[model samples]
Target: MTCDEAQILLHALLDNELDAGHAREVEAHIASCPACAAELAAQREMKRVLADTKLSYSAPAGLRARIEASMPQARPQPSRRSVLRGFAMGSAVSALAASGVVAVVLRQDDQQRILSEVVSAHLRSLQAGHLIDVVSTDQHTVKPWFNGKLDVAPPVIDLTAQGFTLVGGRLDYVDARAIGAVVYKRRQHIINLFVSQTASTEHRPPKTQTMQGFNCRRWGERGLNFWAVSDIGGDELTEFVDKFEAAMKVNVEG
Candidate 1:
């Protein structure tokens, strides 16, 4: 395959989303083509860095309760009609109520979809044969790779001394913009740190939330918004964040 063709299919190839025939073709091309092989190697490294970074935070105790409370409640149906004519009308009303409930439920489900996607993407990255798209611990190398492909520069920080080693960074399309995902590793856990430059009004303080056993923490400061996710326990994740924040502060001050 041509270099351009290989480049176009590289992500899908790495994702193993291509059909057997296509996968074979791509593999053969990479075997003989130095350029394609280098591209594949870069993608593989990115996945490795992401897999090694272990970070996570716990959801506050009332998170689920709050979400449940905020959801709209279904109103009770009217009393059963005495006559056949009234009964038909009552049935229609009941149907409408049921539909309304379904709609509300779907809306709530949509609200949680983003969180689910974030976690699922991380998990998918960990699955066998899936990992980094570009692997490098150097911010200069990783950050430049995203130029022209994304609108903003994701701040890359190395936190190795603090126990969380910077594996690398990548550009991810999430919440409507190309955001930054800085990969880090803590022992056996892999942490994904997402960053974006949002408006001040859009900024939110660091808060932890959990979904499907994974932990997520988000906060905004100094013109950037950040989200960190992992399967690690709350205490350890929090400690990582504290250290990360301290590192950020030092960088900013310097």
Candidate 2:
């Protein structure tokens, strides 16, 4: 893995959020790369200092009791019929929870968290030298750069003809694992197309979400999840994804 790839994962490694495979890879890279080794040491020192510091403010005594006193008095106990009704409602809720309704809710929350992380990754890529590990416009060169680095490399399409120029690719972490990011340029704007393997082989349609002033279009195809994030307008971003997807289909069928 390149330093650029290892740099982003250092934090995940520190937090023990990375899977075993990724943790070993980052650790191995840090061992041989002096620059990355120093970086890891500095991060560890910073974390240690922060942990020793007292940053949280302690609430004053009686705060909860005072707030409770200001509120209206509690209502009387429910009648026997009302108590039974509440019991029935609670049972129904438990049944729904067992039937995966709660899992659906949790999945939505996880999705939002991933989207936030994707935008953060995009912003981090905007920093100098943090963008691409392999700097090249050739789709053939960029695609193979991720061969053994990632479990599955992202599709590298030369979309220069479609207005989004293929620039390079890199390894980035999302959802606690290393994933592939294919970089593209839409004029001055940068697009980071992140790809990761998914357990399910379901093909999901693209959904556009705006976060932190950037537009993100995410979808799933052929058991892989993809997120394309950029500052470009929504319509143009959609056009980019559409064209990119079409090209991917052609490649698969051809």
Candidate 3:
């Protein structure tokens, strides 16, 4: 594969989406070309970093119910004849409806872009020399430290036995509200988990998402919304979430 072609397929190569033949060609090119090799190395490192960091966030409990209530009711399927007539007429109403949907979708995309940016900034901060504005392992100390800094108290759980120690936390402004950034450590890796009390709006469930070398998982429960981001491996990160959730469940029950 030429350098240009390899560059075009870089993301797909990282995602393991390329066909076997294409994958082989890209790999061969990467091995022979120093620049491509460096790029591949960087991508691999980003994946590792995302998998190694330990961050977690919880979505509010009411968010799901509210989302269900707010969802627009499905319109009755149009009759074949009605559909044909509308197509023939190039209906103004249909055009307007389509435009409105596009507008809403664009707006939502913009919001998501902003959220990603905020998350990226927070991630960069952790890598910098100063990670925490308030450093404490005690949940009591960490929770209350945000009393005046944020409007809501973020849950601070210590998972030292699970190989993730509570490093500390800081307050961040995101989605037009003050959110909490809880720091944790897994060996030398740092995980930054953001938490906030969302209103009655259900976001996408907690699933692993990768953005610019970071892995993020978002979920909601008990009126709390959680978003965990790290540069940790997918398997290990999922394991961390499983253990963290189990511990949180036990704590809640108690």
Candidate 4:
């Protein structure tokens, strides 16, 4: 789930009012994301602070009922100040906590923040014309350049026969991990296939997501994650992903 959706449901989440599925997704995202987890921790602290306080207030039960019974059937709206003044200490604490949680959510959108960083790096590379640290169409040479630079060497393939030409390779950091960017070209469009090692509990079908105006298609294979991002059309990008996967499978099987 996105952070905005999580924020809207946070109060319900705190109250234990969210449905099971949504609660699970939000909790999983919160576990993966530190900023959101910190927000959760702050809210928990608020709850702790409120819970620890000794609040003593006993309203004469019948007195409020007796006053309401005597009032006319047609009620008048209370003044804004009166309403504000009428809130109890617990209500004030809740309001403050909700406001603080919303503020934190608005300030730190973890998912989009990471995506923006990835997209920015891509844009910056193109603008500065420094897309590749190692330049070679040959995957052997291009892949070996990563030695002593990064922990893992990303699989580099030449997709020229499939109309996606291998340009070269570059090193990039995205989603808090060091990754190898295998550059490809479709017509004049640039496709950056960022590869990194990430473990997943379950293997699922690849999915495409648009992030900050760039299309990113991500999938997992052989214990590594591949994220291909480009401004190229979705259909074409999907084709590229398909051929790339097929090529990898061939390389593995061969």
- By TM-score, the best candidate is 2
TM-score of structure candidate 2: 0.57
Q: Count the backbone clashes (under 3 Å) in each candidate.
A: 17, 0, 28, 0
Worst 10 residues of 2 by lDDT: 93-102
Scored against the true structure, residue 96 in model 2 reaches a CA lDDT of 28
| Candidate 4 residue-wise lDDT, 26-140, digit = tens | 8988888787788888887898898899786655534543454465522122233433443443464334323333233354576445554555556546655889888888888
Q: For residues 17-128, could you state the per-residue lDDT of candidate 1 as single tens digits?
A: 9999999998899899998899899998998888788756555524533443355522122222322333355664334333333333344464355554455455445553
The local distance difference test score of each candidate is 0.66, 0.79, 0.67, 0.71
Where does candidate 4 stray beyond 4 Å?
A: 1-111
| Residue pairs in collision within model 2 | none
Candidate 4, pairs of clashing residues: none
Runs of candidate 3 with Cα error greater than 4 angstroms are: 1-111, 201-204
lDDT value, candidate 1, whole model: 0.66
Q: Which 10 consecutive residues of model 3 have the lowest summed lDDT?
A: 96-105
Which order, best to worst by TM-score?
Answer: 2, 4, 3, 1
Candidate 3 local lDDT, residue 8: 76
lDDT of 1 at 248: 75
Q: At residue 63, give the lDDT of candidate 4.
A: 52
- Which model is ahead, 1 or 4, in terms of lDDT? 4
Instruction: Name the candidate, 1 or 2, with the larger lDDT value.
Output: 2
